[model samples]
Target: MLEHRPVVIDRTGADIHDEARRIRAHGPVAPVELPGGVRAWSITGHAAARLALSDHRFSKDPRRHWTAYVDGRIGDDFPLIGWVLMDNLTTTHGADHTRLRRLTAKAFTPRRVAAMRPGIERLVAELLDELAAVPPGRPVDLKAAFAHPLPSRVICDLFGIPPEARARMLRGGETNVDTTLTPEESAANVEQWHREMYEFVESRRRTPGDDLTTDLIAAKEDGSQLSDSELVGTLHLLLATGTEPVMNLITNAVAALLTHPEQLALVRSGEVDLREAVEETLRVQAPVAHLPFRFTTEEVVLGGVTIPRGEPVLINFAGIGRDPALHGADADRFDVARKDKEHLSFGHGIYRCIGAPLAWLETEIALTALFDRFPRLTLAVDEGELEPQATFIMNGRLTLPVLTEPAVVGSPSDVTV
Candidate 1:
């Protein structure tokens, strides 16, 4: 066993640029001793990282076997997303990922996501309108008003959560997000989040609705579709994964643009283009800081480091995107105008974020609509003052305060965002 030396995790915030810089100098992949009582091989080089992510020898399946971790068992600590998602998504790799991806593939197509845009636009408009009401000169938490709520609202609509349940589920959204706590505490929170999700799913299952939850219920009619544990993992995954990171997208993009006046001007002029800008933000500032931890199914060698079997590998995709080695000198520079697509912000191969499309849609809608509605929108609080969540899970600003001009309400058009 590695000395498992106590590495202090900077739970106060999740800026990994320094860590990435250090890893870049050291080597592509190295052992990262986490602050908490855990350790794993942290992979950083973009090309090498993707190669590792794509290789099947490294498994996402937690049951592959490993040393017992701090706080809780493997399944409880780093489990799958939630219930309906439990049996199929993420946990099972190989043919199982393929099968589940195939079964639900049609649901997330670009056309479908695009079709949901009007609703997403509506949600953005409503959120921004409320944000505009914050008294001027007072710092309003945009993370609460816009960043966090936008994605949850979109997810709620996707699942067809009713108004009463939607209000209840938003709390579920806040709690389910990933954190830097011990495995036991995180798992307990996860189990509680899962119970809420189960009741929500069960409500839909019993009532028979049109949302994705109902569809999932119908899709797996034979209760056999999801095991007890699988259900908990899947639901937790959606609630946490879906809400937290995108909140950063909104907060980070606003901060990035505001900090760079030239970039903000370009956005205002439409000369720089918002989609490219958003994509650039994604590449430049990754919202999620931790590498997706994969266990070594067998012995593997890289850069003179031989990872023994069953030792967990922590591939830090966050750093892979900004590798000066891969992206060149202009790499670190956040230029929305520069089209850089070789980013590792999303994982390589099959493990890449399945919700990327939805996330992109939400971000694109939020950003574009903001500029379109209030060209004068600017941070109400001092940009440097925002409190970013203290965790490696979904690293992002905890709140964003913005002052905006009143918006002209558009027709109440519902587009099923």
Candidate 2:
């Protein structure tokens, strides 16, 4: 086991999975420091994280509950402040949390997500066609060409952003999730994001359309009592959560498959189910590495370590996903056929991700289309050369360059030829 140390989360040019394993080696709860030298706790065990996330003693409302935040130690210009300081469902608790979540949930039901299948399938098909058009010998950054745009496009369509305005909205959303940006750049990006979303909400009010945004607005009109800031915050949350996870999910899944040919063969041969593959990818390489800055109401003993009151608690979902104590010594290995693949990739309890169903559908469709179109897809660069996203929050490749061999004519590429 590695000697427990104060782990810092500046993810630039670092291999996140390896770093996560090192943290896990330190024990379930480890000393960690954030970007601004802010001290915190990192929950690195699966069971421990599940408990901490659901524990009522911990609050997500950084603005009201976080002492560092209240004392100005953490400011809006802080690189990670945008995540913790939001006024959305993620940052609220008790009745307010229930009310906001209920209002948003009403519009984003399982039925509504299911209804998006045909459109999602169509969009995936179009993207696969574009990938096919790329020349065979040359490499294409699949992350840029496909993974990033697909989810944004889906969310924009569902949000009823007119076709014309989708581009600007997507650009803003991209900047908001990017951790590579300097603190100053992130602040500017946040401001730009707020301006765009605020305008979008007002526009939706003026001209409603057959979209989820309209549905949410109508729900508000029907006595939901959603304030303007809350409404915009909800919309921003939807856009950010909707894209970041799905984008990373797709990118990580592809990276996993291309690096593990035997597992990819099982997927291609239908021996291993696609759902199983996606779930395994989620378990092995969680889309979100660590959830930033959940504050404790009081001093809490976690994994035999005492965390002081109002200190930030970062749930290291990535570390937990690979914790051998929970998943056995082979937890780090990617095995699509592995059973008992329980994981906290989508989080646990009330604060769990609301867009999980949509994310699953999008990833499944994207993978299915890409593989069906070109079964011989392989990485253009060495797996080691694939750079991870600079931010510790998201564990995904910056660019996934791949070479897609043409599909076989006589039989499916996995079969003959």
Candidate 3:
């Protein structure tokens, strides 16, 4: 019999919601294939995704019995297994994962996320001012103008990355995140990206700054901190988590609000809490549509079905957030004040996003300033003209072009050009 050619159920926000419904109605396990002969069972139901992801029965270690299910059908070098072999957080398991987690956990505490606020607010204003300078009614890619810079610059700043190195790191950061490439290509790029980022840690350690990287390096220098691999990988994980999702959330949230002017007006007029609203948007449509890939260490079962062993069992991030069974009647609606933390935007269980507070803080400040700034700002190009990031992992409007003319919504200044 021919190997199963997997079908793609959800490629966009609409499809992701639709697919989550489909999976819930059809039960938990769904099949899909990679470019090679590798087949994966995607867990769409939120509860099932949680269970499958957290269960110890699932063998996360790829080296377990690799000869049978995974042979040379692929290649010696592959991206799927590289994640487990390299870096810090993604590669470790058991005691190792636990140890490193303890050291880094302090940095992500709600207090720490809260502490970053003023700096984040200042950064948000700078980004908006830069965007405001762009002529209105003319096309400006909001991705580059506002959505992009707000988080990219914030993350780079938080990590103590210098301005001169920002462009190179930004380019490599996306390449490091792309999950679509062939195994060899992905592996090569991931390693090179880490090597490129090593300087960020080294530069900070040598001449210490008040940024997160410097702090982390200092921790590592103290007793029982992090290994070099853990230091770099954890830093890399932080960047990956911080940049893509926050930017995606900004663009996606702005797009959603712009489309629903009533919602925009409500947020602008202070009828909604930007924090609760940011959570609602993330739940409704997550930017990182797929959770980073995790492996099962042993044979596991979900929805009363067994995943034999060593299979790529994925937790659908976007699908889980929109599951009707979890969110009740208004699950489909985007209401900023909706308090639904049950949604899995930051994930659930041990591996839940540690930087969630940071992510939430960044989005709240950015989106709040966005609607407030352009009380009159509207889309520059037709919605269809915006690019779609086709990769499953990062779902977002590639370039959201919006118009900003006349006046700053709440400001005394008005511009002619």
* Candidate with the greatest lDDT versus the true structure: 2
lDDT of 2 by residue, 1-417 (tens): 343568776646266777776666677888877776778788989888988878988888887779988898777767765777467887887778878888888767889899999999998888888888876655788998899889988998888888788777766656655666778887777678778888988888998888888887777534666788887788888887888889999999999999999999999899989999999999989998887767889898888678788988888878888889878989989999998789999988887888888999899889998988887888888898888887778788889988786434454333211
lDDT of 3 by residue, 1-417 (tens): 232335554333334555555555555566665434556777767788777657665544444433333554445355444454555656566766667777787677787778889998998888888877775445577787777777788888878888998777776557655555667777777677777778777777789887788777767423678877778878777777678888898898888887778776776677876666666777887787765455666676676666666566667777777776687767778776666646777766777777777777788777777777777878766666666675566768767877776534555542221
Q: Output the worst ten-in-a-row residue range by lDDT, candidate 3.
A: 408-417
Q: Number of backbone collisions per candidate, in order?
A: 19, 0, 10
Task: List runs of model 1 lying over 4 Å from the truth.
Answer: 1-8, 67-88, 167-178, 182-184, 220-224, 339-341, 405-417
What does candidate 1 score on TM?
0.84
Predicted structure with the largest TM-score when compared to the true one: 2
Estimate the overall C-alpha local distance difference test score of candidate 2. 0.82
- Give the CA lDDT, 0 to 100, for residue 295 in model 3: 62
Residue 95 of candidate 1: its Cα lDDT? 68
State the lDDT of candidate 1 residue by residue for 132-229, as single tens digits: 66544444566777887899878777777776776666565454344555656655655666677777777766798766666655555323354444
TM-scores for candidates 1 onward, in order: 0.84, 0.92, 0.85
Off by over 4 Å in 2: 1-5, 11-13, 220-222, 406-417
Assess each prediction's global lDDT (C-alpha) against the native: 0.66, 0.82, 0.69
Better of 1 and 2 by lDDT: 2
